[model samples]
Target chain A: MSVKNEKKFNVVYGEAVGAVAAHSFGEPSTQMVLRTFHSAGIASSVVTGLPRILELVDARKKQQSPIMTIRLEKSYAKNYEKAKQVKAQFEEVLVKSLLESFTEDLKNVTMLLEFSKEKLAQSDLTLKFISGKLQAKFESIETEQEGNKLKIKYKSKKEMKSARTMFVNMRNFAIKGLQGIKKATVQQDDDGEFYIVTSGSNMAGALEVDGVDKEHLYSNDMFDVLKVYGIEAARNMIANELKKTMDEENVSVGFRHIGLLADAMTYGGSIKSAGRHGIAGNKASVFARASYEETVKHFVNASVFGERDPLKGVSENILIGKQINVGTGRIKLAIKKEDLKKVDAEK
Target chain B: MVVHEVLSESEAKKVSAEYNTPIDKFPKILQSDPQVIKIGAKPRQLIKIHREDPTGKYSAYRYVVESV
Candidate 1:
């Protein structure tokens, strides 16, 4: 590498990078839009702006709205029909979604389920498919199908309460597609290539579907990325996601600061939040941990464990009004034995 | 995943000596990690990762720890 490039990448020892990263993220975040805008149609509502920054930093297990952008294989990407077919494999269909109305005939101990023909057509499912799935779920119950309806007869006539419970259970039964995925929509990207954007994320299951571009699949959920792709990918995701979120708000920040933050968060081989419960909480010095959060808890634990603070870190030294160990404060004067003998004690 | 290679025992020792740190003290990667599993690495092994940065490319080292 060139000297200039080497210098650009090297962080000076004793430089407070954590403080710099914090300031870099903190200043621009003030200008971020507070409101989250929901796009029309079946597209997932993305959490953006200041809220998104918090979501990434906190590393929340359950996202407000997790989304995934699934790319297709080369042959399928150029065709709209192929992309739609892939989308159907991800969008889940529930029995209740296709039902028009369900009526229970207590006298006959039967339930009449009215299926909406329009919904069935839109979902690309037939009466047979639905009936077959229902039959598999309840083998003992007898089912008779009409034009757009099915009549289910319970074996035991007098058990009215059990029949009511069965109705609730049948409605929630998933007939097809990956579970947890609420909806999937096929969209055309800038290059006229078709892809699928889903409201929910099921990375492992989605990867199994045909025509999916396994290498390029992306999810907004950090845990999913960590679980599927491992630590390095998760680290990159954090930095890229942070940069993308900032770009959407028109805020300009250097990638270096964001990269530094990401490296610090994942250098320990796992994603850790920047605050109290994670990185901050794991500081080696008791005083540093106490100063950040849960002050009394940290102090009591330290005392109980007979923990000693070396007073090496910035926070601990600052707490005692000593110079922080950074920049010029990092320099210490040393007197050689011969020089010490030469120095006047009185002076 | 980034481009990575599992180092031999001798190579791992050389890295540990060069960095002036013990092998176990290095940053850890779980043995069950997908990338580690893909590479078929075992516990107490070392991995050298080639990372691409906008400024330049650099190598990072990780120690494989048994998954608990």
Candidate 2:
């Protein structure tokens, strides 16, 4: 490379590119209203704009909505019936949805359950299975399937109050599908390929579903991705999700800036927010820490811990009115008369 | 053993001295980068990436400092 090219590509010393990146992202973001829009027909249709980006950068533990997209295998994706079967497996079925009505007796509780011949056969659910599941929890329970209605009688020594609570508990018991996932539906994408979209994220459990395409599965939650695919995948997810949200809002920010932010968030091998509780609050320089937030707290901690600030960074140097160690400030020149004489002699 | 190893304190110091660049200013690689994990590289360690052109006649060298 020529000296001219080197000068062209070289970042000016003390330029504070961090501030430049911040301005690039923040200026356009001000024009965007902090709102989320809904898109119809899309399974993962939540379009949270700037607020979502803030949450990601801050590395908030809880998000507004956590969703997962589970793509099925090639064969299953072509068949509507196969996709429905997979979706059913992801549904969280409660015992309450199965029961019609219940009455409490002195020593036994009697319950009536509505049955659908076609639906039961489709879900592979039988009265025998339900009875066995109930019996597993309650010792003395009997079931009688009469036509379309099934009656359950529970004989336990517990009192009426506790029996009623037990009855409520039994009603909420899961008969099928994975827990945590409230709803799942098979939706066709732009390519006409079918995949399951879930309301709640349960990556590990959803991956266990038969015919699920492990490689293509995606979740909105960064931690869930980290738990299943390790840190690299999570970092990529952060960048991609952030970019998608930004693009939806019609705001333009360079991908490299977002990549840099993601890299900062996960540089420690663990994901951290750029908030007070994470990186900003834990700066090495005392002035830098005090400048961000909770000024007194940071000062008090530094004082009590006998911390010393070297004042090497841009933030601390700017705070204390010192030249920051960047750009031209990074270079130190010391020329002696003897050295000048030597140079003159060499010439 | 992992192919990527975190450079020891002395090794990191040596690399910085050789390049005559501050460690912080070195080209960055994330701790979550797959190649960094495969070699078990950590923050502040210098990583050397060697690649060859598809034609097999050209080669390239790049260095990255792992950061979190």
Candidate 3:
């Protein structure tokens, strides 16, 4: 079989945008975030705008802007993806650690405060230290807006729960530095760390006992706003790419179609599946055989697994859908030699 | 002299950038009586943080960046 004829890989592409980097995620957080990574770009790109992420990165390095390349020896853990994962992992670890430390059960952990890994204006040891601390679990973290103040609803559990008790616990936790936080001139940790919740700056090493969480923070749109921002900011770039792709391939696709394609690309960069658990619960066979089994676990109800709905509602393909053994119909692939020869002769 | 100090995961990076050094090449661990060898007159590729200055900055001590 010809590889190109295979539908294993669906290149769902998107454009890079910003609230600023022309169309990259370099935009500040004050801007609106996209719901799904702009899909409208990639479907068009191979057809108009540009190529895709791989191609986009290539074009960027070739640009005449002196290539804003910062040479670091071995800091692979500092990229947007790695950093975001690290932050997320840290939250998990922090909560688990805190629960273990306090010998208490875990609560509904929420990332009350969030900042873009790319938006930090400057970085230093101090910022890293403080961030490391915040990434540690402090019980309950929620994003709330109170007039102009960003009320980071925090609830810790080294003890009991009460407004005054929570406040006192929070205040005490503030005073005792988490070992190696950064020192600031007008330290905000005095009142708390929530005050320093500014964008384009890392919260590491910037906190002290004197810091106030409220003082440092402004009204945040959402904790995971950056997630949307990063995806949406790619709108223009997505549009241009989709335009190019569709035009080149002569495949007319609307913004909605491109949007679906973009979402797949941004998250996993494939367009061969759809529905609720399409990418989340189960991956297609193309991803890997292991992915197929995972998909089975995600969709079908087996004796091993209780009854479950396959998110394959939108991903049903009759030609090669390897889901069931015997359902409404049967799939027979054992072809005899005579049938094969007869079919070949007809073709 | 090689400035040896503690750096956060991010600062550890900026420090390397400032020095045009690779992160993998940065001094990270302490050896028990580390075998110090002088390769010609060039300095040793080592960055050790003093016990006191674990804050990752210029502390009350001074050290030379030497090569083994």
Q: Which parts of model 2 are misplaced by more than 4 Å?
A: A1-15, A34-47, A94-175, A337-347, B1-68
- Report how far off residue B41 is in candidate 3 (Å): 73
Tens-digit per-residue lDDT, A1-347, candidate 1: 46466666577777998788889887877756432343224353677777788999998888888899999999999999988888888888888888999888866778888999999999789988887888888776778999899988865565777777777777777788876689899999899999999988889888899999998999988889888988878888899999999998789787778988888788677888989988899999999998888999999999999999889998999888999999889999999987787786645
Which number leads on lDDT?
1
User: How much of the true A–B contact set does each candidate keep?
Assistant: 0.50, 0.11, 0.00
Which of candidates 2 and 3 is the stronger one according to lDDT?
2
Interface RMSD of each: 2.8, 9.4, 23.6
DockQ of 2: 0.13
lDDT of 3 by residue, A68-141 (tens): 10111123222434333222211111211121112112243222223223222322113244334443644454
> Cα lDDT of all candidates, in order?
0.84, 0.72, 0.31
DockQ of each: 0.50, 0.13, 0.01
Q: Please, what is the TM-score per model?
A: 0.78, 0.66, 0.20
Clashes of each: 0, 7, 69
Q: Across the candidates, what are chain A's individual TM-scores?
A: 0.75, 0.72, 0.21
Ranking by TM-score: 1, 2, 3
Between 1 and 2, whose TM-score is larger?
1
What is candidate 2's lDDT per residue for A209-310, written digit by digit as tens?
Answer: 889998789998888877666555676788889888888878878765676677677665568888888878767988998999889988999899999988
TM-score of candidate 2 against the unseen true structure? 0.66
Candidate 2: C-alpha lDDT: 0.72
Supply the global lDDT for candidate 3: 0.31
